[model samples]
Target: MFSTRPRDADAKQFIAEQKTLASIDQQVDAFHAAQPTAPDPVIIEHPIDPVLQTGDSQLLGGAMEIKSPWSEP
Candidate 1:
């Protein structure tokens, strides 16, 4: 046995709160849409790190030589 006036008031209050949350969500989405996104990373053909290379590094002109402690000199 519930009164109709109180039920209507509660429904209206819930709808208003939901609309407020929806408005805040829309604002946040618009803010992110206005910001600029980062650029994609540069692609490399080989595993060489060009940024940290020096003059003594071997270029991609020929095959790289790997020397290990187990290999004879």
Candidate 2:
């Protein structure tokens, strides 16, 4: 059979320990709250030129004529 009488010393110690943990949690929360949050990244996208977008045969022929820098003739 379980004892009906309360363990006062154990209960008091448990409560004190819980209070200490709660105080630590509060301090951690306050420390985080005081810190400044980082700003969102700024994305700058430049518009593509219409001339570069076109697939021209002359451009491809000119590009093909250029020898590879790694290869010797």
How accurate locally is residue 39 in candidate 2, as Cα lDDT from 0 to 100?
A: 50
- 1-73 per-residue lDDT for model 1 (tens digits): 6675777888899999999999999999999999987555543344566666645674653334443334345
Model 1 regions lying over 4 Å from their true place? 1-5, 46-73
Off by over 4 Å in 2: 1-6, 54-73
RMSD (CA, Å), each prediction: 14.4, 13.9
Pairs with steric clashes in candidate 2: none
lDDT, residue 33, candidate 2 = 100
lDDT for every model? 0.70, 0.67
